[model samples]
Target: MTTRSRTAGPILLAATILVGLMAGTFFIFACAVMPALSRSEDRVFVQVMRDINDVIQNPLFLLAFMGALLLSAAAAWQSRAEPHRWWTWSGCAAYALVFLVTVVVNVPLNDQLASATGSATAARADFEDAWVAWNAVRAGLSVAGLGLLAAALTVRGRR
Candidate 1:
């Protein structure tokens, strides 16, 4: 490998790891925390959902999402010249799907929930179910991306 490839390879690897961590956090929040919250009484559940809505709307989540997208894109670009180009491309595609799903489905639903009131609990519940469903899809894509990253790392190490 050339000096540039050597330098870029490590950077891309780091980016992939970082994005994986962010995606993992999101998956855990949805799968673990949200489910536990749903077990509570109606009022508590609504409040928990509202709190989750607030957390998701925060700038921190936005920053993590955007940062991960950019980093993953960079990693994908760098990987094109690597021997395991397919793994890199697959990871890129998975990450892109995750972002698209979040933007298309989750963001709108989150916005609606943000505007909802106690009187609109029924509507919120409908949206929340949809959100959970979409989140499952997101989590699956994230796992795929993480797998791709791992595969790419392994391939790179052997080269």
Candidate 2:
């Protein structure tokens, strides 16, 4: 194999792993975290979510969240000349969808939820259900992106 192809294989693999990591994180939030949060009293839930939002902004999570975008972009670029380019390209698009939704929908909601004052119940009413709904979309998009990246890896292997 040529040097470029050899390099593309590993880059794409790393991108797939990062995308999977993001997908798993969102899936857990949907399936486990949100359900538990839903059971909490409104004040406790709001406080817990605020704390979580603060903690989740740490460097490691940032790496995975942002790395998925950067790495997928790299993978798409590297695989551009390959026969299986569509898979990587589509993976990139899916990741973009995830990012855009998070930035446009989720982050603003989180910000609003975090800084909310007066009535926790009112905040919960305004934020929690809608946030959960947006998160489900993120979960699905990230998973789809991961699956496409996995498909790209498989196609690369076959080449």
Indicate which candidate wins on lDDT. 2
Q: Report how far off residue 139 is in candidate 1 (Å).
A: 0.7
Q: Give stretches of model 1 more than 4 Å off.
A: 1-3, 57-60, 118-120
For residues 8-73, could you state the per-residue lDDT of candidate 1 as single tens digits? 677667657766876787699687977886777666766676777776666776776776677778
What is candidate 2's TM-score against the reference? Answer: 0.96
Best by TM-score: 2
Report the C-alpha lDDT of model 2 over 63-133, residue by residue, as the tens digit: 99999999899999988888779999999999989999999999999999988887999999999988999
Report, for all candidates in order, the number of backbone clashes: 0, 0
Error of 1 at 153 (Å): 1.1
Residue 34 of candidate 2: its Cα lDDT? Answer: 96
- Candidates' C-alpha lDDT: 0.76, 0.92
